[model samples]
Target chain A: MPEAVRSALAIAGKDLRLEFRTRTGLLSAFVFAVLTLLVFNFSRDQSLISTTDLAPSALWITVAFGAVVAMNRAFIIEKEQGAIDALLLAPVPRGAIYWGKFLANLAFVGLVEALTLPLFVLFFNVPLGPALPGVVLTLVLATIGFVAVGTILSAMVVRTRFAELMLPVLILPFMVPPLIGAVQVTARLLGGRPLTEVLGWLRLLGTYDVVFVTLCTLAFSAVVDE
Target chain B: MPPEAPLLEARGITRAFGAQRALRGVDLRLGPGEAVAVAGPNGAGKTTLLRILAGLMRPTTGEVRLADGRTPRDPAARRRVGLLSHQSFLYDDLTARENLHFTGRLYGLGDLAARASRALEEAGLAARADDPVRQLSRGMLQRVAIARALLHEPDILLLDEPFTGLDVPSAARLRGFLAAQRAAGRGLVIVTHHLAEAWGFATHVGVLARGQWAQLGPRPASLEEFLAGYQELVDA
Candidate 1:
């Protein structure tokens, strides 16, 4: 791997290993995603719109909500354990820290997405075909977007009181455009509809990723500084 | 004599948060190996001034110049100008070694383990090097915090209440460490409201008041003179 990517993965890998060791944040997020999808199955009308019509929406809504939950606890280990200051004193670019965080968050939320994807097909019975790869692609791209904003916001809200409540309240509204965009593209992909139909939302999701990743990287030095 | 290159210098640095003025037109200089203690009452701009000097917060009105005659470039400068603040500035989840290695990576230090191991020793945390900071006692954690701060081998040291909550032994050891850093030709600035130890080891001292500096100079010609000046400020 390239040096930059190696560093990025190490950041992600370390967080994953820590989470695995502590079973602090990631486990709950995974269970929460699975349970959320189960609730969606019992509550929603499966017949009105082909579950496929809403499959993308259901999956991403699950992912988005789970992202908030996962992101809330993302820095808990660092903040509570006293590791944050250690990370800050290091000579790594603040952007590297942000990416490290983003990747960790991306892995966490991606695990939730991965778990729910099968259950998404099982419970909602969304039709799957060659579009399986497309759905996976959409999930990864949207994970990057989810993590970019969530990572920056998590760093801010974690230090404040009412962290758990504050994160979702702040994140869910901002999550809409991309959440809708992810769902729309997924629906089109699963339905085997023309890419042209979903391209608008696809572009919207792409744009959200670019703008947020850039803004967060630039503003991150303030978040880490004392 | 000739201004001595002011190891770290700030010209007209000003920062205001909303309506409250944190710092206003503050200019200060530190020469090589000078340890300046910044003293002020609560609400004084001591913390704000240190933040600006550390390059964490950009000054609204002035510039911070390094002794090398250049703009404060990046984290490396901030790393070199170390501050021991109320905050530990560490990663709580990672063990001491993990924490140090992370920082070592940032400074591009080759042989991360060597740097980290040496720092752990310097902080007197070698025995507890593998323990998570959360599990360490306050004093041990303080030592770890010091090790983390010194991992990069900074040229200037800034301490903001470094002694807060430390036991006498820990503080004594810390005092020795700070003294050694000063002896090594690094500029050190410490800000504290506590008078007893604040004024003890420092060579040069500065008093900050109401968003401005009131006085700054060498150690009192006599210890009694330092107390009288500090007491006057406290009573004022």
Candidate 2:
């Protein structure tokens, strides 16, 4: 319903505003992602690292690492300020909160991936063309999947004794499937493989996004209810 | 519905953490506009009981029912109940008004802006509606939590340590708020160690030791006798 959407957007908007006003997390994610990409590019020769070779792997890897960094800070301030309880008590569907967080994190991660993509292209001379849309779509799916797992895990670990150390330890293994699918599809496309040849990976990625998102929605109440 | 049906009925509620028992076969009730104060030392399962009623935690052995015959058989039914805890469950990132609107929406209230505005006004936070909750003092934050509970006009309001961190003024205002809510035909339950504060507003009082209810009913006319009874329960 519109009411739920409004509430979800309100929670999401508040989060986005907080993140924007204090760009510390997003900036760190961007810088770390760019640094990783740079390191990857320089490690190989220009001929070996071209769009045909490194474009797919580099883009998805940068995205994966950037999202992981950003996810750690997702609930950092909320837990510190004791604001999460208020959000949990609101009447909005628990699922909408999931959407709000997923979308907000999506926007931030996507921005980093967007910014990092061009740099990757420029550095590796990967021809972006029509393939760009497919890549962005893949990025969105992967980001949603990653942020879904991240938001729930972040909420759980944020208040624990050692949050920063514990979150990645719990979340990394679960994130592997999405990251692999993202990198594989990107690589196959950059290698000039036909969409049909790589469509199965995209299907797997899409399925992961849908299934995990639904699971997160159903299970998020347990996370905040604690 | 039986005229004698307790306004709120808790039956066979049991919760445990590891090998320790927080609550075991606890049963209690509150009539309309009545108050129940739960007194117990730490680790007595007082909080665990409140959380279970608020749907934050599930009972290991029992169920909560509306004495008015409106049982909380499902999620929708449970949403109508209110709970205020020591945690001051306010999102510090949101303004008082924003927080109200958000909670109101969760309760499926339309015209959230108007309800939020009215609740803020009622709580005397209307003037500071736009200020983030973190900027407010502990007293003001408590007021915001109270406003959120009353925003939906729930039939049952649960207060757990409502005055623990409050200043004198905030505590007085909250007592007034609870009395007014009782006047509104809502059942009020206060869980606390401050028997004096509980006596000030609650028409009914209960002593909970370990996991059992030792004494629960109308406040004895003689304050001295009730205090003696309370002390006896604590010591025994």
Candidate 3:
């Protein structure tokens, strides 16, 4: 691997270890995801909206909010002891630091999705037998798009007084594109629609991922620079 | 780069925050085997200057450069500078050894395990290497931060109040360590409030007041002379 990638991976690994050791951030996100799912399960009028109809929206909504919770911790850890300055002083490209945080957030959000999926199925009674692959693909692509945008926004608000509140406010707008894409693709997939029909949404999600990832990676240096 | 070139140089460096200026037209040159101790009152911009020198912050109007004419913005050039700020720059959950290992990885240094081990031993934290940083005392945390700063072996070191939390023994050890660094031809710019800390090691001593150097020159011949000079500048 190239040195930058190696450094990025090292950072990601370190972040993962810290998360696993403390478990506070991840646990809170997981609990939030579960609570969101429970609220959706209990409040919906089952006669009007079948489990199939509610599954996609419920899952995507949980993910969108859960992601905000997870990404909020991304830069908060660095801010704790002012570790971000040390990271900034290192002889590595700024893009590497951006990618490191991006990848780490990707894993964090991905794990939340993974843990939430089974509960989502149990609560909604949604059969994901044939559409599991499509659902997984939608999850990955949409996650990349939102996490790409979220990583940079997290860094931007980390220095602010109201970072915790500011993150969801700034991030929810950007999360719209991918959340809509994921819900559309997932709803169609679960409704037994053909794969051919969901291709447009997938393409939109792919484009969003590529465009935002590149733009955010480029903007990160300026965001973190003093 | 010529052998005689200053290891670290800054010219006309100024930084401002909105309506307030923190530093203005400050300049410094640090040559190999030389140490400069910068003393100043509160709000003198000593920390700001150190941050700019460490490349953690860019000056609003001036520039800092390395021996080869490369600015701190260059990744390669940044590798030659080490910084120890007031913040420990350590994760509370990680152990001391892990912190060193992580820093080594950031610098792309090889033999991380050995290097971290040696650094822990040198800081007298080998027994506590595996303990989480949150469990260490303030003095121990400072020691770990110092070790982390020096682990990569940079050519120039910019330390901001490095002795803040150190005990008497640790402070003496740090002074000895810095003297050894000077003996090894490394350049140092140490920022401190106490003049005694810089007494024997600093080849030059300067005072910063209101964001500019009030007085900057060679070390006075005696402690009394240096104290008198420092008092004169602060009083002015």
Candidate 4:
């Protein structure tokens, strides 16, 4: 394996181990997501409004908010323990550090989304049989986009006095493009729209993921450099 | 004959934060088997200088180079230097052994488990290796921090107020450990306010005032003489 990949995996593994030990961040985000799904389920009557129509927006909103909660804790731990300095002092490349944190956050947010998916299906009463594959693809792409920007913004705000307040403010604006793309694609998949019809939204999501991931990776070194 | 390049050299380092200058053309040279103690008043740019030397921060104007002529900014050069700052740079949730192992992995060291175990023993924390860092006392934390810094066995060690929060016995143990490192020919730069303690170990001493080196040279013959000189320099 390449040194960069090895280093990244090491960091991701360490983060997962710590998370496994405490489960504080994961548990909080999971509970919040479940509650968000429940609130959406109870708000509307299924007879008047179709479950499919509401499922896309509800699922996306749950993911976006839950991701914010998870990413907010990503660098806060490092800053609190001064582990960021130790990381900086190491010979590892800055991009490795960013990717490591990105991978860990990706897994965390992905887990929350996965756990919430079953609840979403049960609450909305939507048949995800053939649409499951498309929904999974859309979720992965959208997650990459959400976590890419969320990871960088988390690092930026971790040192500030009002870090918790600052994360949503800094990330929500950049999040709009990806969130919109994700919702449209998800809605199309749930509605069983032809793939050709939703190709534009898929492209939008792909472009957003590629562009932001590259941009954030390049910009991370500057963010962490004192 | 030209002087051989020191193990580490800082040439004309100057740093400023907006209108305030923290380091003004500060220069230093460190070689193996030498221990330099840097003493300074508050806000004398001690921390800034150490950070620059460690390549954690860039100087406004200057450069740091390793003995092999690699710039401090180079990852290869950075790998050769160890730094222990005021912040322990430790993960409170992780055990001492785990923290050291984590650092070893970051450095890509082979045989990490054995190395971490050795470091744990060296720090006198072998019995508590599995305990989380947050559970440890300040002195124990400092000891673990030292272990973390030395885990990679870097050629030079840069320490900032390492004695802070250490109990008397811990402090003595640390001094002895550092002395051993020096004896083994590792370069050391220690920043402290405890003149007496510093004098006991330093072969050379420096004083900084207002972001400049007020006086830097060999250690004075006695603490009284060093104090008198330090007072006059700060006053002047």
- Per-candidate Cα lDDT values, in order, are 0.76, 0.77, 0.93, 0.89
| Candidate 4 clashing pairs, residues 3+ apart or interchain | none
Weakest 10 consecutive residues, lDDT, candidate 2 chain B?
Answer: B67-76
The order of the candidates by lDDT, greatest first, is 3, 4, 2, 1
Q: Given the true complex, what DockQ would model 2 score?
A: 0.48
Score residue A4 of candidate 3 by CA lDDT.
Answer: 96
Of candidates 4 and 1, the better by lDDT? 4
Candidate 3 chain B weakest lDDT stretch, 10 residues: B223-232
Tens-digit lDDT track for model 2 on B1-236?
A: 65655667889999888788888899877778888877787877888888777666768788887754555534455566788877766666668887777677567777888888888887778889999888998778888887887788887888888887678876887788788878877888889888788777788877777887777778877767877767688668
lDDT of 2 at B140: 83
A160 in model 4: Cα distance from truth in Å?
A: 1.3
Residue-level lDDT of model 4, residues A137-189, one tens digit each, is: 88998899989999999999888998988998899888888889888888888
**Residues A1-226, model 3: lDDT tens digits:** 8889988998898899999999877899999999999999999999998988889999999999999999999999999989999999999899999999999999999999999999998998888888999999999999999999999999999999999999999999999989999999999999999888999999999999999999999999999999
* TM-score of every prediction relative to native: 0.87, 0.88, 0.98, 0.97
TM-score of chain B of 2: 0.91
Q: What is the fnat of model 1 with respect to the true interface contacts?
A: 0.45
Residue-level lDDT tens digits of model 3 in B180-214: 99999999999998879877799998899989999
Error of 2 at B40 (Å): 2.1
Best by TM-score: 3
For model 3, what is the error of residue B144's alpha carbon versus the real structure, in angstroms, after optimal superposition?
A: 0.4
Instruction: Please state how well chain A of candidate 4 matches the true chain A, as a TM-score.
Output: 0.97
Residue-level lDDT for B109 in candidate 2: 79
The per-model DockQ list reads 0.45, 0.48, 0.91, 0.80
Residue B101: error of model 2 in Å? 2.0
